[model samples]
Target: MNIKFVCFSLIVMLFHGSIIAQELITPEKAVSLALDNNYGIKLAKTDVEIAKNNADILNSGYLPTLTGNAGANYNLDDTEVGFADGTNRVLNGAESSRYNASVDLNYTIFDGLGRSYNYKQFKETKQLTELEARETIENTIVQLFTIYYKVAELVENKDAVSQTLNISKERLLRSQYQFEYGQSNKLASLNAEVDINNDSISLMNTTQELNNAKRDLNFVLGNTIPEDFNISTEVDFNNLYDKNELLNKVKDNNISVLQINKSIDINTLGVKSESSAYLPTVGLTGSYGWNKSNNNAASFAAYSVNTGLSAGLSFSWDLFDGGSTITNVRNAKINLESQNILKEQLLVSVVRDFNNAWDDYQNKLSVYRLQEHNIKTAQNNFDRTQEQFKLGQVNSIEFRQAQLNLLSAELSRNQAKYLAKLAEFQLLQLSGEILNVEY
Candidate 1:
């Protein structure tokens, strides 16, 4: 008849039921599993590793390249030769062979600091990848919490419905006994039966919703099969967050803003790298080569050999390439400017979202508290109505009304509690602090 008694009874029933034997998944474990198993997180981490590898000096055009070459060729054919003195000779099966080998090295000595800027850009790209990975991790954790809370909410609703069903069963039994003794009319007994059926349907629907919520939670955790488990129906959140502090943290740590800032740095480096193309490029080139030839036809010597080492300095300046270099430089500068604008836009959007989430959190928390108070009032009213109904001072309709009122209040309170908790998570997420939550 009252919320407190119903809760106690529901707990006793659950203790004897299968729920006591089910696995209890805590928030911490859920997040840990998701981090290990989620596909998005795995790919993000891979991208981060690739970016780190790309940041190496070998990829930055700073190291010299060495190459080796070797070749051999042979020919057999009839040959004829004529001298300037009017003498002619002919021979069959003339044989000739040639062999060559070389090793070359090329190095860029100077490129107007383009290599340095490119290397810095690589490092910045690596940082951007790391930040993107962090964002993925944060988003996954937020999603995990959302589903976790949803399961908890549905579980609470299921418990509430179970309690209501039990009360309806008891009322039906009492009504039957009173009717047999002629202390209650047949219509009252019939109404109680109908109420029992309605409660049964509500219980069934609540159970179905709880099952679906659990399945969804399993998917979020990357579970291929649904796990039979129970969740703690407790929604906890920080009630003392300072708005100004959160806003500052958003500016400092929000993933989108950080990503955009990193982009701006990379684009600035791009501008420098492209501008370097305007200056002359100085390079060093060296090679050691060997060649040998053999001929059996003997118009001259039978064999000749040549071997040498060569080195040279090379310089080139792109005075004009149909304005391509200038265009590239201009485009790089434009990209840099665009990134700066994007950062500004992203900051504005981040601030607006944070403000909205903050307000939503506060509003939902107030609503939850109001529902808490309302449930207490509903409980007191139900208790009085239950006592009056026993003494026949209240009709069956009035008693049922009180019962429904208490059930409705309990459901509303559960919903409000989880909604407020979700809003709190959103706030923390905006501040980039959701990853720091302790289960």
Candidate 2:
């Protein structure tokens, strides 16, 4: 069956414009709301944006660095000067002032292609962040779908329990009438009343359980709506995809696999980044400067000013650093190998998980189908017994048994249906298609 149809069948709802009325929400609406309001998804998006910013070309090491600096200094202290001709002078309040300013430019001419590797690594990191966001969205969607279906199942079960409770109430009334008119014994009326009380308690418990399920659904939707709501009753069990096909897609599309692959690329680049330490680093440095100094003495004062321009090509080769660079390169290679192994392991796990989910889905489908047939038979039996009870051909115990059987069959069927849906959802998530779910 089409995936959209399957999702639609789970939460088919109609909306109206009335504040006092129950709000009609479908699984699609809930998912959309959660996507908009979920804190985890918002944070994941922020991380993607940050990675994108870090990957910018300007942030790469290829860009030049320019800076301007200026400084002034003043000093006052006793000073003495002596010349080679044996003339000596001394001043009590000797003062000196100096000023300097410069504009410098520095750029890396080459670094063994380390900048290129850095750029590639950052770009890959950005892609990884985007994939992480996709993972977050997929998780949220699966969570919403699971809770929504559980609420639907509980609602159905509550209805069945309510029906049984009504039947018990009616039986109690009939038994009371028969005893009041002396047509039946007091024990019959007492047993009927006891049955009614038991059914009422069961209904109350079911109602509470339904309410709790609704509350959980509300929480999954980021608590944007009221909990007192009804959900779609339809359960669709249609499997159309092949296990081998899904397994093939998992390696390329699964978020964990993609992340591991990216990590391997980063680690490979890390080896390159570390190998850069072996080669000489070339840089261009240039500066324009102005300087002035003045000295004050009692007899004479002197001052001088100078301006200069300088430029140079600098290179550094770390011939040896006690074997640290070699160790780092070896470490990086080892990390890359480890990451590759991890990717292979994850692929195996993904395939295994997909198989398990597929098998579970098939098994649940079988159970759901069986329970569906049981519902039909149980319905027929209950109808027959109900009629026989009216005709004095069946006892109260027999009629009650038929009612309970029909209810049990319905509850079991709903549970199996949701369980199958859960398994199907897992398969989609494992294949990285859960994020593609349409609203």
Among all candidates shown, the one with the greatest lDDT: 1
lDDT of 1 by residue, 1-439 (tens): 5999999999899887876678778877788888988888889999999998999877989999999999999988788888889998898898999999999999999998999999999999999999999999988888887888888877888888888888888888989899999998899889988998999898898888878888888887778333788777766665588899989999998988889989999998999999888888999999999999997774598999999999999999878889988999999999988898888888899999999999898999999999999999999999999999999999989999999999999999988998998898888888988887677
Candidate closest to the true structure, highest TM-score:
1
lDDT tens digits, residue span 230-349, model 2:
666666555488777888778778889988988888898899998988888899999999999886774254887889999999999889999999999999999999998888888889
Model 2 has an lDDT value of: 0.84
Residue pairs in steric clash, candidate 2? Answer: none
Could you give the C-alpha RMSD of every candidate to the true structure, in order shown?
A: 5.1, 7.2
lDDT of the candidates, in the order given: 0.89, 0.84
Backbone clashes, each candidate: 0, 0
**What local lDDT score does residue 350 receive in model 2, on the 0 to 100 scale?**
86
Task: Quote each prediction's TM-score.
Answer: 0.91, 0.90
